[model samples]
Target: MTLPAFELVQPRSLRDAIDALAAAPGMEPIAGGTSLLVDLRGARVKAETLLDLGRIDELRGITIDSHELVIGAMATIADVLKNPAVAEHAPLLVEACRLFASPLVRNRATIGGNLAYASPAADAAPPLLALDAVVELRSVRGRRQVALAEFFKGVRKTARKPDELLVGIHIPRAVPGTLSAYRKLGLRKADSISVASVATRVVVDMAGRCQAARIALGAVAPVPLRVAKAEAALTRHGLTVEAAADAAKLAAEATSPIDDVRGTAAYRRRVTETLVKRALLELVEKGGDGR
Candidate 1:
């Protein structure tokens, strides 16, 4: 099917792009356009104007500061996979990127777009949430930083205003004794939607007791979510078999899954528990240090 006619506006700068978006009532921003183009062609999205963010060079790089690793909104999945900072500070994101779509899609799928689309199955969200990432939103008014956890309002919905554009993602540097992992279960090995996904970051002290833990899941709810109960169950507890089991059960209990074409709710819930269990066990085997 052919896409409907629309105006494509490429701004010379980020400020100009913001102005273009503000001028149009429901203009959509296009970075890689891998997902947005599909939505446009399928009529799942309607837009009269497309604010091209591609030309804005300010939105396309990776940098690290004393505080956090900053990934530009336009950085493609491939970019994330290649960045050494991402591997060091947030290996969970690197694992998620490896499972996100295919090489062709990853070469074009921007992380910002993945989060902005707010898909329940988005591979990027779980890892970012697990890493305690923050998303930066920019508009003519100014810029604001939002915790990734609070960014999503619901399925395909976010806290971003219509005129605001996602500019960067900031992931705090992992502590010295942190161990993290990400796993996604899909109907097929590749290019398939997730039935369930899990990302975990655990900080273990020298005595092998967990000091902090973050666990996020996807494809089991209206939005990607952190299982606080599961996290609490792990923290302060040694990564013992019983603690892992308890956390896995709580993770499954936290899910509000729905029956879908990819899999049934029961199957998703089961997979969720299994994935969390395996992730935790793997971390323990890796010496509870994300190396």
Candidate 2:
């Protein structure tokens, strides 16, 4: 279906983009237009004006500063895959990008757009959540940072105000002896939304005990979630097979999945258990390189 008619405003700068959004009540920001355009065409969302942020140079880059990887909001999935900084600091994010969609979609889909869309099945959300990422939001009033965990309010909803623009995503550099992995279960091998996805990050001490653990899951809840109960299970005990199995059970119990076309709630819970256990076991075996 063709998209509904809407006025398109191409902003040349970040300030102009913010001003445009403030000026129009129903003005929505568009970066890659990958998800927004689809929503518009399907009549899922309506906007009287679209504030195109593609021309805004300030919101586009991948760099590291002060022990954090700063990814500009406009940075595409392909950009993240190619950036050495992202690979070094957040390799699991790269894994998500590789499974994001087809190359065509990856090239045009901005990381900001993906998060802004706030799809529960969004491939980027799980890894970013596990990485303890933070989003920088800017407006005429000022800038504020929100933790990724708190950013998603629900499915297709977020904490972003109408007048605010997501400017960048900041991820703390993975510390030494940190091991991470990601797995996505989808109907098709490529270009499909996740049925259920898991991203795990484990910090191991010299004695091979889990110092910290983050287990983030997607498509099994209203928002991508970090299973605190499961993390606690791992952190409480050494990274043993028994501990991993117990954590997996706890993770499955924590999910509030729904029966969707991709999967049933029961099926999702089962997959979550399997994936979480596998990820923890893999990390335990490979150990950490501090990368």
Candidate 3:
């Protein structure tokens, strides 16, 4: 199908790209173009200009800075899947990336686009939310950082101002004792949107007592969510069958699943609870990333 009339900007620098976005009357930035191409062809996202950001050197790949693991917005899912630092420091993300589309799409799909689009069933958001990730956003005027918890506003919605470009994703450095995992319920795994997704990250003391816990869920609410009630139940508890089961119940309470073509809200709710149990129990029984 022929695309509509659109001007293209190929900026050599991020500053030039920002200016281009600010100046275009109806401009949108694109990387990979996987999602936007569909929207543009369907006439769902009307834009007279497309600011392509694929060449921006500053916005790509993975790095372990002194303070955190910095991931550029333009980094492809495949890049993430193969990066050793990401696998070592943030395996939860690696796990999620493993389940995102296929090798063909992963080679093109970017973290920035996925989080910016903010689909409720997106595999990345829950794990990032559980990791306490931060996103760096830039506008013509300045830059700001927002925690992932405050990022997603609703289904297909986010806190981003229209002019802001999501520049990078920031994840805390993984240290010893930090344990994390990601779980997704897809119809048959390949090319399936999540029926339910959950991510759990916990730090256990040498004696096996939980020192910290974070539980985030997706495909059950309008946005990926942290189950505060579930986290509370785990932080001081032991890593055991009973503790995992109890946290799963709290996670179920925090969800507000809706009936959809994928499954009934009730079904989604139950699966979320089960997924949480599996994640936590798997951690207890098997230890860290099966790697």
- Per-model lDDT: 0.90, 0.91, 0.86
Flag clash pairs in model 1.
179-290
Better TM-score candidate (2, 3)? 2
Candidate 3 lDDT over residue span 50-73, tens digit each = 888898988996899877999999
lDDT of 2 by residue, 1-291 (tens): 678999999989998888877877478888898888998999988888888889988899888987899999999999999999999999999999999988999998999989988989888999999999999999888999999999999988999998999999999988988889888999999999899999999889887778999999999999999999999988887677888899999999999999989989999999999999998888877773321
lDDT of 1: 0.90
Q: Model 1 off-target regions past 4 Å?
A: 288-291
Q: How high is each candidate's TM-score?
A: 0.97, 0.97, 0.93
Q: Give me the displacement of residue 194 in model 3, in angstroms.
A: 0.9
Indicate which candidate wins on lDDT: 2
User: Could you tell me the lDDT of residue 259 within candidate 3?
Assistant: 92
